[model samples]
Target: MSICKWIAAGTLAVVLSSGTALAQGNLDKLSSFQTTGVTEFTYVEQGGAKAEAIRKTLAGINLPDGFSIDLYAIVPDARHMAVGPQGIVTFVGTRKTEVWSVTDRDKDRAADEVKNFAPSLAKAIPNGPCFSKDGFLYIAEQNRVLVFPAAEFFYESPDVAAFNVIPQGELVPPEEESYNHTARVCKLGPDGKLYISLGQPFNVAPAEKLDKYKKWGIGGIIRVNTDGSDREVYTYGVRNSVGHDFDPETGDLWFTDNQVDGMGDDIPPGELNHQTAMGQHFGHPWFGGGDTRTNEYAGEDVPVEVVMPAVATEAHAADLGMHFYTGKMFPAKYKNAIFSAQHGSWNRTDPIGARVMVTFIDAEGNATMEPFADGWIDENGEYLGRPVDVTQLRDGSILVSDDLAGAIYRISYSAQ
Candidate 1:
């Protein structure tokens, strides 16, 4: 590669590896609505308004002055985003086993093209994609990881039928292992393995909960070799950790666990935890954060042993995607902070989360949660957009995915 190409590649790599930029959590937009010239985009739903309708961008969001939000991409069931080969923005469609690619070729910086990077298997649902050093893409679907080449083929088409590279590491623990329906793909860190977030399938289980979870493949982070070998359970007792990333500075793995339902609308806030050791458990079903559990699992010393989240969000915020900030666009204080997406809640009497949140980490590695974006949800709990994943661009600007609108918003900074 030429010198300029090398520099561009390095910059893009830094942005992708930057993790998450600081944003807001729980969708609290504290702004007055302007009734004039509000931009609105709508789509026709499949069966009816209640069916799996194609949601579009609406007017209630309150954006900061000088910062404008636009329709970035129109993807089908787009969920998560990662800066993939050639700086292309890649996202996952949960219902299918296909990895969708979004690109901005006109230099307008808006995503204008869409294609599938990899196709799905009969019963698999693609969750996330992570790139390797050798220009390979490891995608996580239902129960396995599919490796694909062409880390930089932007104009060319992707060959999903050719993926055969499997993980080469230890297998996940059989006893606690359950075939998780939604598995997230992530590049293994420090240990050089592929880490998959395996979520528990149920909210509550019987006294002998072993059979329920172990049989279904929920509640843990599993690590295996890139060649699809030597899988091992890194941790257990996790609920649904859809969004997870490793701290580039410390090599510690961090994940956002969604709070369980039926526990009252405003109880037990979702958790952000750090994996300090192997096989560590974080009080699922038995113990919870925010409000302590009164059940048999509660008042016990088990959840206590597991390190509490670096920060505690509002109850039922439904925190999903998380990334650590490693860019220079924002202030230096935000370098160690984490950016997370709060997928709006359905059960809350009034919707709570729908924007990105920032978790500030101190010099000692401690963390505190705060808001970064505050306009996706309106005052009356009306949601304008639901942020799914966060991606940092090559220029340090942050890209947020709104699955509700099938769009991506680019966030940049400029001093007045």
Candidate 2:
């Protein structure tokens, strides 16, 4: 298509609306966005009634015989986490505006401080924070991408160096912004690019939005250069993926996607997808999840060759965040396995999946998933905690964030 035709096809918004983001060849002011250096940061109390209550819920959590779980920090609306490359601080993002800086200053496994990072800047749904191998931290907000150079080292101060990779109102066309399915997740790919997921706004995306979604990478994953240039859609047909990680050994991209809702109890399963090559499509409007066809486009011919999921989990369990286990603290059987969290169900008749899952991969690259932790739900079906994201610490132990409980939990294993 000619450049004129591309603009005429409703994508003029890509140029007209995204001024500083797409129009500029380079970031408007790279490494210049900084805060006011306000020292009065609001800190989450390490010891309090709330902390004890969240700790008490640990008794109901069941892990492997030699594994144990404990409260690591107190955070509000913790969604996804990024452990700093230097292993000093762990940056946790939330669906709300703040990105938390968590530190265990005493090296005691439990966090000694929980405070907001970059207090002077305004952030919208900064749900994904990832770090480069060297030190820079990149945060994926709802409609913006910001980078903080040496964030782990500078987080002790209220003001940290920041830059706009993709400026606000530019990650997606501003008009497509919605509350649902907007929490993005990002990772620095093996190719040295930043990969970010852009979710379509609706429960089941409408056909009218398909063209624009394809053009702007809505409902798909898009990757860009570290400076936010050379942006393009990397994967297609994803509904909404809040969790993704690269295979430690293979460098393949694996992600967990939430399937279409309002389908009956068990019609369409949740998805754990593996993308071996670029431009692969996972099923969306045509097939809800697995082989289940969606009601909206049942009779229509599917547009793209859809890549089936590596694992299909239970329906309505809401698979959210995941991590590829490469830690040495666990047994050899778990070396390259996948550890993921299910945030549990909302509209199901009998609630299920408020637990952590372990997926083991074989020599043939096949996957088998089983529950690694459970019992976050009560007998009356009330959720005591909802696990959002999983990440490993420098010590090789893993941390799980619970948004419902507003706390981070540390899980480790020790042979007795």
* lDDT per model vs. reference: 0.61, 0.86
After superposing candidate 1, which stretches have Cα over 4 Å from the reference? 1-68, 119-123, 158-161, 164-185, 211-217, 294-304
What is candidate 1's CA lDDT for residue 269?
A: 82
Number of clashing residue pairs in every model? 39, 0
Off by over 4 Å in 2: 1-37
Each model's TM-score?
A: 0.77, 0.92
Candidate 1 matches the true fold with a TM-score of 0.77
Q: Which stretch of 10 consecutive residues in model 1 shows the poorest summed lDDT?
A: 9-18
Model 2 RMSD in Å is: 9.8
Q: What is the lDDT of residue 295 in candidate 1?
A: 59
